[model samples]
Target chain A: MSISCDWPQAIIGVLLSQNVDLVAHVPDAGHAALIRLAEGHDQIDVVTLTSEEEGVGLLCGAWAGGRNGVLLMQSSGVGNCINALALPEICRIPFLTIVSMRGEWEEFVPWQIPMGLATPKVFEAMHVEVFRATEEQHVAETVDAAGDFAFTTRRSAAVLLSQQMLGAKQFKEG
Target chain B: MLERRTLVDRLLRHRPDNALTVSSLGSPTWDIASTGDNPLHFGFIGAMGQAAPFALGLAMAEPNKRVVLFAGDGELLMSLGILATIANKAPANLAIVSLDNESYGETGGQSTATAGPTDLEAVAKACGFSQTCTATSEEALDAVCDQVWTAKGPAFINLKIVCGPSPLVFPHSFDGATAMNRFRDAINKLGQTQGSYGRSNESEI
Candidate 1:
């Protein structure tokens, strides 16, 4: 059950803006589109991490090697990364994180809501800048902007792409 | 084993200006004692494993500057895989110093991998770090400092520091907002001054 959407294009734009040579991720239902896009790309090195925080380290390493990279994870995973995010914040490393938000808009599970509600507040408390991706049309531009912010600010920035933006179909088949 | 304070003092004297320092959420108050106006970045957020990688980013972003990671044994164990990556992509300017207290001192001294007779120096050696030192006394630490700092690749120093209070009040429990803002401002200021790229004004998701 594939849905016709420009999500792939937005992800590609993010990859381009970040100069993302390495992709580290912990798989989730909502990121299927972006993960698929990463898999198909030959220029990027996609590594599946054991945990969300490990992705932070992977991105940091890639960034050190003069490669742009992104960490793709779910909102709940952000909770797991509060300490991890500090790595970029303190080191002044521009880190781009693409997070799939849960517990908002059309959330079906109860577990995701706690972290969903806490994700933004947690990021805010951690001093990490966050942006939300609510619509399909805005995904590319938002991701590009986030990449710019991360690079320019030399800090961690996130794009909280809503579940609706990815659409239920993206997850239904997964 | 070296007393925690002695290790902190040595680091303070040796750490160069513009060096980036990252500390874990445990004892060994090196950040509190050593960090001055210089660009010192410490992690006081969620108690998890993150210091080494963050230092990796700083080392990458500012290759000319030295990057130091002051991690706890517990925290280092949380993401030991980072060592593999660090070894594979050797960063000459990066130094990882793990304070081995043999417990999760932050969470009420809970037992972790270090609680047993585990040796972190061996672990780091197995992970391919060319330079690995286990310092149980001030003399040992001082003797190893030169080797750890002068190594061409990634270096690991396992300091057997005694456990004590974390020294940092939990920033997240209160005044979290204020602390976050301060950190944000500091980061932005550094970026504006040192980063080659400029920041965008638009907010993104």
Candidate 2:
């Protein structure tokens, strides 16, 4: 069932409802609005990571301390996080990642395509279940489901926000 | 000038039993493990450069307890940006101690950037860490160790040591799941009796 909503707002609502205490990210175009929302949330501690891999370790720390966290990153950033993903899988720490897609539809940057195309497979290889939200109507529900799957099952889960939903980045001429 | 393991032991000596510690995937892990296996200590098997970030999260999670991170110079260099991230969050209960042996002792004594001239303490100071220091002598490290565990932090200390092999002491259970579950159990048990509940529900585990 499709529900009409602003995707970022809907996803942020789910994150808050899920009681995410920590939001760690290396921002991407698709996650910009969500990042702002997380930063503004009174209960959340927003951590800006220099590299995507650190987000993995940070989330594990949150779990160790008896808290929950969500990691936000772009498709290319997934490649950087591949190795560290082992932390969640091996330790059985619940983890949620909201990935904004690129290089799939109406793509501008060629470099992003390789990772975008490989992102799902990469996560699957790391044993993180992947959920996709290609349409705005599915964004909130998809995020809710992803968080449930991660936390309830004590497993790694990722929600891929489609490039179509985000609108491809436009290259501006200087 | 300082012996690596000796300094590591000294730093951890007299630390509170409840404090959480995370060791990088290198000699620091072995050194810390050599001191003893407390469920409070997390020995990172493979994730390099994540010690500080891990400790930062733990500190935020358990605001009342101190969290310490032990990492090698090479590991810290790989994720130098973490200093900025830690500074930005500025968790009061977190301390990061970098074992600057001037070389990648685990990979063979290849000189690291710190050997030539990369001062991690200076980098940490620039990143806005208020309690940043480089301890070259045993007495100096003793003084720094006191502040590391007790002082308001986001504190960072770089301990210069001679490069050498440390005897490997693996955590009894290499299974991350086993170690992690036990660690969480310890925290939960503490919460139940101490009247300071950790983030977990008693029944959850």
Candidate 3:
């Protein structure tokens, strides 16, 4: 049985505290709670995307307009963003993406493995700094640090919350 | 067939003073640059299929101000699903204008999905645009531009254009950071003048 965690609340608190005005995401179970927290918040505007890459454009526009935004997606979604990420990378728009990782350590899904294993290296090749958090206690602080580093340096950064931290996606019988 | 440059020029002339314009890469950016390099007009140096999503963000950020995305049909097709995302958010101040020249002009006149059977206007409607229409002639283009600027929208317009011998008018810089900062500066100035919504320079410092 999975007990609820406080990290989602802590992460949301830090994002709001950092003055992030927009939260753009594609639906992923790993980020569902945090997404709900942001959607319920009055200060932040949430833009749900059909695909992950759209978040890149959304955040670039936020940066252009002098607002900050975060992209929340799963590890597989990072591959969808390779080309679109160039918008912020080339433009030097400050960006933060908190990625909920899949396909490592007791993972049930096979298709997710390739991209999941490749996410950090892919982001690094695109010039986005990558940070990983495997422990629940490190979640909020890592997010805060990622936001600070990305925004202050005017660079794109990602914090990958590993499967161990997110807990395994439960397999259920139909 | 509608001429893209003339249509973009017409669109700009009728666009509101506070409306922020985001142009996609390639001919759309050049066409916007040809009009003038206003700080309010952000030209994508290289990002394709991003103008609409970018504009969507800007529209949400500046709810009081209007935001328009100008892109080629080919470019818009690359990220066709953004239309649904835009509809889901449904920012009242946002509008999208697709110049359907039927070919990717930047890539040497290769035909695109629009050239075959893809109807972006219909797709936008299916995605739930509050107002959606198309323009195949100059008169229709003028009429659509009117609705594009003045109407209550998350509007979508497919302005069909004749791909051609048009000269490219390059934007002064390919630097994305420069473009981003310039746009922010312009918005800040506007906010300060209007006494609303602008970030203070001190916080940035």
Candidate 4:
């Protein structure tokens, strides 16, 4: 799906509110817009990691340095991060995460379903909080709120964005 | 062998205020009981392997205070990369003590990476930890307590403890809301004395 241009603005606001100085992400088609937004921002140190778990480690390190950080990835990526999330849970280093949800929102692929169904349950199992974002207007507020909960609580929190909010991109053919 | 309770008693006795304790899901509940006013950070969240890294972060953020990571052998094996990272960074206030029961006690006592004679003490040394030891008896465990508590630069200790179920049980499955209020209250209290550990300015991109 093509992501909305406004998505970047909302993300910027969320980052600003959360005071996120470092971001670790594994590239996802749904989050390309958000990734671009992260890359263009000079203040945020964007680390493109090899795997979702790696991002978790990076964020853990960033948090230790007294910097707020987040991990951006797809629902499947959340699966990869289950054990990784334990790090934050155990250490009490609260950080915000933005998950590009799939499997539930007209997903084109089948593999995304397992993780989508498992995402909330997994977060629940790990003691991480999960929040879903359905619209552009909800993006900033949801992300900010998750960050607040993370910081105030000193635990991991997440915001899941549906594929619909990403919007559809236009294509031109000869 | 060191009874798990003895280890817990010592840890509780020595636990500093605002200290961070990272434990695997179900290793030792006795310690949790003694957590008291000190901030307790449970590591039952995601990667079993990343506890040390998380503890490292907390310790780095609060250099004056001690941060203890109560890890399991299974969990430690999962994110061994963290040891290398800890070695490189070498935060003096971080104390990582693995409850080395040689099994993944949480998932029905299955065998783990330390099942064989992998020698966690050797691993800690290889990871550049200067102070590394294994405690098989109560006296030994206590003997090392002072060093574990006061050692500078990323210390690792393996407690040869018997495995057991976690004492604390959540009403439902574990998640953010279950311990959120208590944890938040504890962190807030710590923040009052430690100052705000969170960053004020946001990242631009």
Candidate 5:
């Protein structure tokens, strides 16, 4: 059973503490609450992207322009951003992304499985540090640690919201 | 069609001190680099279709400075919807120039959609660009310069050019971290000098 709630509020607090002003995403139900919180914040400028890869470039641009940013996406969007990850990897720009998981616990869709399982390995292949948030208390601290580690080291980092914590998406059974 | 290197050199010669530049991968990157490099120029070494979105973000971040992207037709096609994304955001400081050579000039010149039925300028206009032009000649290019740089944007320029064999021109440095720092430092300095880092239009930094 999943007990993690208030993860969205906790994540937003982490972003604010790190002074992240730009937030980009391709809308996903997993991230809906967190996205709204960012949008509601006066200091955070929200960018809705056509694809996930665009967020990678946009955040790097914000960083180059002397601002901090975050990208929120789902596990499937990870496949769309593999090559674009080269920007941060090759350029060594500090990057942070929060990925909400799919295809775990009680997955209703089979298509989300491959990418969901491959997500961490894909990020690791690109040398981006990966951290997982499996418990309510760990979500904010995981993000805080990843953000600090990425910015301080000028390296890329990602925080994965586990299916158990996020509560697997429920679809009606016929 | 215009010669790309000649056209880039000419346009960049007039690039104001307050402007920022982003270049897409391959020929467009080489074209911008051939004109001579600057710390303000953030040329892409490998992010193929990302130049436009990156430039948009920069423009949004530093609305006081003009941020222009020089991209290739083939690369732009990979993410044409980014034009719509930029249009929606409607950053006044952003401009995108597609160096339309009608092919992937670096990869032995294979044809792109622009060679067939694609009209990028029309695409931009359809995507909500208020100022757009397809410059087929030097005269046409010259006519659009002022608006491309100074108009209420976001603007799009589709510059038609023949795919000529140009040498690989690298940016000032290949070090990503170093390049990023140089760009960040420059942006910070501009914000300080202009007193517009977190001006009224932008959220407080």
Candidate 6:
């Protein structure tokens, strides 16, 4: 089944093919479709988290348990996961986080701007490679290659889905 | 309140072979090492608010093995939301035992949230755990001890421990890479032998 969110569909397809079994996520409008697909999939187990940081630890645990996992959250959640990324960095625990972008050039919400802009730099500081997909067609391939390198090389990577691909969130003044 | 180190030693003394242990950094980690290092223990170098979630992940991944977390009350407070997360995931092979000294032992026994009105056991219960408990004395801990090892979990036990300094027993190594390698290999190679991990091919770091 297909939805208007084709990027989410493609991303889920890549994750499924990569044998990713556990998906830890905090709810975000951009990830709604992908989260739904992950929940319905038989091979993937969805874990709802109260915050994004927990996903980092949870994914490492999955590795220790002999399983592969992924984390889904928005750019704002990136700030929450900074310190937690230390685990993957020092331990060489391979993991992936698919981030939905917000606070771009045309963003209506000013609050999202700081984190969205700083996302890549923050990840780089922790030695986590950052990959961006500003176009829908490139989303699947980017995530697939990134995911492969991350799990195989035992390194952490973050795939940033740009706000352009997600369209603009309009702010209305009443 | 029950003494923290003594409680940890007691629990490890009767630890099940099919169980894997995850301890938070600092005092709890020291307490675990004090008992004696085991290949199965995953001691954290510095992921402060992550012990319980890590345990949950391991428990879900290794359904055949029980996973327990030994964390400090202050550490758990840093990520209180994890309680709700763990309860929702509801990994039957998981249990969390917070050494509730109501103080941060590493930071000079400063008072913590649990020292005030916060109750971790109640929080766990409210978060939808199958079993939740609080033990103020050794007798109480002894009675509910089996619940941690062989009960229908995810269980949460708040051990109200005395606020004081105890001797630190550091792990052989605090490197996250070494710990992860040992832990991952143990789970993979140890699955068939009732989860009791034997010597691994990798040299211990």
Task: Summing lDDT over every window of 10 consecutive residues in candidate 2 chain B, give the lowest-scoring window.
Answer: B193-202
Residues B65-127 of candidate 4: C-alpha lDDT, one tens digit per residue: 667777777877876766766676677878788788888776788887677868787888898
State the lDDT at A117 in candidate 2.
98
lDDT by residue (B7-83, candidate 3, tens digit) is 88988988788888888888889999888778888888676788888898778777788888888888899999999
**What lDDT score is found at residue A162 in candidate 3?**
95
True-vs-predicted CA distance for residue A86, candidate 6, Å:
0.2
DockQ-based CAPRI category assigned to the predicted complex of candidate 2:
medium
What class would a CAPRI assessor give candidate 6's docking? Answer: acceptable
lDDT, candidate 5, B1-205, per-residue tens: 8999988888887788989988888777778878887878888877787778788878877878888899999988999978988999999988888899999888889999999999999999999998898988988877778766788899998899997698888877777667776876676766553323532111222
Give TM per candidate: 0.64, 0.94, 0.95, 0.61, 0.93, 0.93
Which CAPRI level is candidate 1? incorrect
How high a TM-score does candidate 3 get?
0.95
Residue B122 error, candidate 5, Å? 1.4
Task: Provide chain B's TM-score, model 4.
Answer: 0.81
Best by TM-score: 3
TM-score of chain B of each: 0.77, 0.92, 0.93, 0.81, 0.92, 0.91
Candidate 1: where is the Cα deviation over 4 Å? A1-10, A14-24, A27-48, A56-69, A74-79, A82-96, A100-138, A142-174, B30-37, B41-47, B106-111, B164-205
Q: Compose the digit string of candidate 6's lDDT tens values, residues B1-205.
A: 9988888888887889768999998988889889997888998858799887788888877777878999999889999899998888788878899899898889887899898999989989998999998899988978677877889899998899998888878996888898788878776766553322221111233
Residue B171 displacement in candidate 1 (angstroms): 12
TM-score of structure candidate 5: 0.93
Candidate 4: stretches off by over 4 Å: A1-17, A22-51, A54-67, A72-78, A82-95, A98-174, B34-50, B106-108, B163-178, B191-195, B198-205
lDDT (Cα, tens digit) per residue for candidate 2, span B13-106: 8788778888888788888888887887888888777677778777778888888888889999988888899899898889998889888887
Look at candidate 6 and tell me the lDDT of residue B129. Answer: 92
Clashing pairs in 2: none
User: What is every candidate's C-alpha DockQ against the true complex, given to 2 decimals?
Assistant: 0.19, 0.57, 0.57, 0.18, 0.40, 0.47
lDDT by residue for model 4 (A84-171), tens: 7766676566767888887875666677689988998999998989888898777777888888888777878989888777643333
